[model samples]
Target chain A: MSLINSTATEALDLLAKGQITSVALTSAYLQRIADTDDQIGAFLRVDADAALARAAQIDQRRQAKQPLGKLAGLPVAVKDVLCDSQTQTTCGSQMLASYRPPYDATVVARLKSADAVLLGRTNMDEFAMGGSTENSAFQLTRNPWDLNRTPGGSSGGAAACVAAGMTPLSIGSDTGGSIRQPAGLCGVVGLKPTYGRVSRYGLVAFASSLDQVGPLAANTTDAALLLEAIAGHDTQDATSLDAPVPRFSAEIDRPLTGLRIGVVREHFTTGLDGEIEHAVRRALDVYQSQGATIKEISLPHSKYAVATYYVIAPSEASSNLARYDGVHYGHRTDRAELLDELATEQKELESAGDREALKNIDNGLVRMYRRSRAEGFGPEVKRRIMLGAYALSAGYYDAYYLKGLKVRRLIRQDFDAAFQQVDLIAGPVTAQAAFKLGEMAGDPLAMYLVDLYTVSANLAGLPGISLPCGFTQSGLPIGLQLQAPPLAEDTLLRGARMYEQATEWHKKKVPI
Target chain B: MAITRADVEKVALLARLQLTDGELKMMTTDLSQIVTYVDLLAEVDTEGVEPMAHAVEVSNVFAEDEVRPSLPREQALANAPGRNERGYLVPPVLGG
Candidate 1:
């Protein structure tokens, strides 16, 4: 097999045996990226020289028989949402187009500590605001399976890079299925660990409460490996769980006898495409025949997950995004231009003898802020900020934002009650397989509704995984979603691994 | 409730964003459709339910209140679109 087709685990085994050097592996990926990135658009930036240097250092350590980190020499791509000291962390937005953070996010730090080569930064939706990477301010990343279709997003580039073999492993932040949605579309394994399971210290905030950093990889085992390397407590993030990190890969091969798999009845309702439902049901059969108990379950309040998430996420976003004015950092307008405009306004007011209007003109700072934000954000971002501002406005607070919060509680309650009956919940990751580009364009609501099956896990702070289940007649991959109770990713991984072994879906290569 | 052009204008002002007349019209329609869809939450009976802010049950996570090394001034200000000796430069808040 070609070097690019090897999974991270397989490559690591070769490196340990001295059969392959880190420099060779990293160079192969860099060369492939140069050759194919224009067609895939998976990468926003690739620092080839830095990557090779890091890989050579790892090789030197190995050749000298010195102690090495767990992921020594592995190349890993990171979503643009995370802060990296070596690259501009744009969060895939024009607002921070030239912005580079001085400090790396905790996850990036951990990747370096593990001796992994920093592959490069990948593209994403502007601030993770949309499901499709089409919301990216840079280039749109196409699904590796079909260039005419989208790689589901805001972590679209993260998943596409893995699917396209540009990188063996990539880390992405999932705020309402950004990681898993794109992973599913691109036919790879994506895991969204329980909220607080992974530190959110360096992640660009979208919906603070729902965001989590997790892994996207070629298979379940590699996904678990990447997750273990990054998951842990950090003092920098207050929400970071203080619990000891579990050896996630240690449990992947364990047999899951008598595991209770709850099939969410609500997930199979109207609008779920027939092929996806069929594939998910077939996956349930694989579990049932393997000594697992399949029970029908219902999360009644999940009907409101999309509605609740929309209101709550945007309300938080409006507040979180307020830091970007033409002041401390990010894009700013020229002061001279603002001053000239201010002079014109003041002269006009003086000629009209309207002294009161001059007081507002004195606040040219506000004018600069307004112009900078208006020019900086894209249409989707501005829409969310407006929605958030309206929802949090004094009179509407109780009706929209507050009510959304209360509904969120009910959604959590629904999950808590269901977990008591089953160990894991199984369902379709998305309503359908990857759709053609521009299929849902012009209607943001249509795009928002596609998140219905995946958002509940995020709303309730549960860990969920999306793995390839089967393919459509047109060769599009379908995903089966398995969600576990809080911090039960080990259980989720074991179940997904069993399905992966019994089926050939994950073995099929992306046509790219 | 249906959002109007006036509501979009008000929200835009509150968000400190200066939307053009064309954008304002488009946003008025878009927000109206989105708000109407999200209005489905009103159908749920959440009476007396406590509002959930964070998904996990976490309280004030405090660290020792001690001074720590911070980012150097240059690195912190590296990404500023406009900066100067004092700090980030901005338009005058006071009339000359």
Candidate 2:
């Protein structure tokens, strides 16, 4: 079997047994990426030299009879949203196009410590704003299953890399279903760890309160392995919880006897694609057959998740993104300089009865800030920033932001109540499988609706996982989503493993 | 409530974004549609529900008041689009 096809766990075993060297394994993925990435567009950047160096270092460690890290030679792709000092981290935006951080994200640092080969930065929705990676300013990541369709996003490229067999694992940040939705569409295992489970130190902030970086892997075992490596508290991130990290791989084989799987009634309601709903229901049956009980539960306020998320996420995004003015960092507008020159002309023009010439020139610090941001951010980003600014603006905060907060409480309470009766909730990851590229591009709201099932997990800060369960008639992959109450990743992964083991769905590869 | 073109322009200004007239018109429609959808939240009676800021209830997370290593000046300024010996250079503050 090709090294790319082996799971990270199996590959690590092979590396340890001297059956395969890290250099050889890394070279295979590098070659695969070079050969296939043109069609897939899964990566924003690939550093062949650095990747080989890291792999050679791992092989040297093994040859010297030294202890190796858990992921000694595995090639892992990282979403561009995560910072890596070794490569440029663009967050898929033109604003950060030439920008490179001096430090690696905590997750990236952890992956390196585990001796994993850093494949490259994967494409994402710019600053992880949109559902489809078409929002990416760089390139569209095609679903490996069907080259015409989206890979689902903002972690589209990460999931596509795994689905295309470029890498066995990739890391992605989930903010309103970015990771899981893409994972579902790409037919891979994507886990969004509980909020605060992973450090967000070097993750470019999208919706700070909602974003959590996690693993996207070819299989549940590899997903769990990757999650274990990155999940922990760090002093750098204030929200990162000090909660004890579980050995997720060790708990993967846990039997699902009497596990109460809650099938959320709300998720089965209107707008879910028929094939996806059927596959998820069938997945529930598999769990039922394996001694797990499926119960109908309700997250009554979950209907408000998308709306609440729209208000909350963008509101936070507006505030979080405010730091990107030209003076501090990111793209600076030459318009500011031109405007300054124009202001001088404006004074003379105004005196000469040509006030119209001064319309676009506001030559001050305020002008620099506005002009830089205007040039830097994309349309969707600007739309979100405007929506957030309006929502949090003076007259609307109480009606919009505050009301969204109240509904957020209700959403969390609903999940809290449901967890009392069930260990985990199961549903479809998205309303449909990967949609055709540009399908929902004209309608931003339609794209937001695609995240209906997955956003509730982020709304309530719950851990969620999307595992490939079945496919549509058109052969597009459908994902079954499993969510657990906050900090209940152990239960969430255990439940997903039960379904993953009972079916060979995960073993089915995209014909990339 | 339908977001008007003026409303979008106003929000755009507040967001430090400069939108063209065409973008403003499009944004008006888009924001109106989004607002119409999110307006659904008003239907759910959130009576007595407290506002939630975050998923997990975290009090002020205080690090020890000790100085630690921070990013070196060059590393911190590496991604700056405009910089000089002092720091990131900005447009004139006074327009003088």
Candidate 3:
């Protein structure tokens, strides 16, 4: 296999036997990124000098017979949402365009401890707010399969880089369908670990209750390896599960006998493209041929997933994003004249000892907060903030945000009941293959509908994986999503692997 | 409830975002449509259901009150757009 196309697992084997050096592997990927990233727009920044330097250090450690971590010498790309002090962590927004975190996110710290070569930061939706990477304030990441279509987002850059062979593995965050949707569209493997399975410390907060970090790779084994390396409890993230981390890569190949896969009756009824439904059915047939039974399950409350997610995610975002008021470490608008006027007024009020009057006057600080955010955030971000504020506002809280939460309980109940009969749930990751770049640009609601089948997993806090099942007639790849009960990542990966082994979809390379 | 231009303006102010006239118009239309779409949730029978604030059941993750090393003042101030020798500089808050 070409060095650029080798999976992380394959490259690791070569490094272990001394047949190849980390420098050679890292350089190949760096070179590939330099050549193709201009067209794909998958990466926001590539630190060639830093990556080469790290690769050399790992090579020397190996030569001296020093012990290495699980992902020693492999190159990994991280979504810009994860903080790394060495580079600017722009969460694809101008609000954080120049913000460099003082410390590494727990996941980035873990990757460093594993001795993985940090290649670069990939692009994402601004604050992970949009379904497509087009919301990125910096650049638009195009699908490698067809440049005219979207790569699926907000982890579009992470999925695109892996699919386009720029990196063997990349880390992505999922709030709703950010990771799985893009991976499905790009014809790669993407896993969204159960909520709390991975720590969210250092991850730029989007929707705190739903955000999760996971891996995107060329195959399930690579995804498993990356997950194993990053999964564990951390003191920094209160939501991080205290349970022991499972060796997912080691257990991935174990065959799952008498697997009961549930197919939701509602997932196929409306807005689903015929080609995607057919492809997912064939994937189910592959499992059936392997002696697995497909059972029809009803998650009746799933129809409300998109509606519930829109309300709940935005409400949390409105509260979490209040900290970026330009007072600390993000974009601050320039209002020199207003500040000067306010300063003069404050001096006069303090000298006169008019404390009550001083407290009532307009300070310009509130105006600064408003203008700075207005200048920093994009249209979709602004819309969501407005929606969220309105939902959580005084009179409307119960009608919107509270109602959404109650419905969320119903959605979880639907999944809990389904899991009683089936070990896993299978469906299409997206309603259709990748859409054209501007197809849903003017319509935010239409764009949200794309996440219809995938949001239920995030809402229910379940582990979901998107595998390359087949392709559309236009050659756009289709993803078959398998969701397991919370913390059942082992079963999720093995189930995905079974279908992967039976089909040749994963072997198909991007035309880029 | 329909989202009028006034509603959008009020929400934007509450969210600390200053939108232009064109943005306000666009947001009014868009938010109205979104609110209408989500109104379907009102039809779901959720009586006696408790509101789920989080996906997982976790609460009061307490840690010992021992002091640990924290970021140096300089490092913390490094990304501040406007900072003085001691701390961040911002527009006057009280009267100034």
Interface RMSD of each: 1.3, 1.5, 1.8
Model 2 CAPRI quality: medium
Q: Please tell me what DockQ candidate 3 reaches.
A: 0.72
Candidate 1 residue-wise lDDT, A17-71, digit = tens: 9999999999999988987889989899998999999999999999999998889
lDDT of candidate 3 over A1-512, digit per residue (tens) = 66877779989999999989999999999999988999999999999999999999999999999999989999999999999989999999999999999999999999999999999999999999877799999999999999999999999999999999999999999999999999999999999999999999999998999999999999999999999999999989998899898899999998799999999999999789999999999999989999998999999999899999999999999898998998898999887855765678788999999999787555578878888898899999888888899999999999899999999999999999999999999999999899999889999999998889888888889999999999999999999999999999999999999888877889898886
The better-scoring model by TM-score among 1 and 3 is 1
Give the TM-score (vs. native) of candidate 1: 0.97
Give the 10-residue window scoring lowest on summed lDDT in candidate 2 chain A. Answer: A354-363
Best TM-score goes to which candidate?
Answer: 1
Real interface contacts reproduced by model 1, as a fraction: 0.89
Sliding window of 10 residues with minimal summed lDDT for model 1 chain B:
B87-96
- TM-score between candidate 3 and the true structure: 0.96
Per residue, candidate 2 scores C-alpha lDDT tens digits across A94-163 of 8888887899889999999998899888999999998878888888889999999999999999999999
Runs with alpha carbons beyond 4 Å of true place in candidate 2: A335-337, A344-361
TM-score of model 3, chain A? 0.96
Compare the candidates by lDDT and give the number of the best one.
3
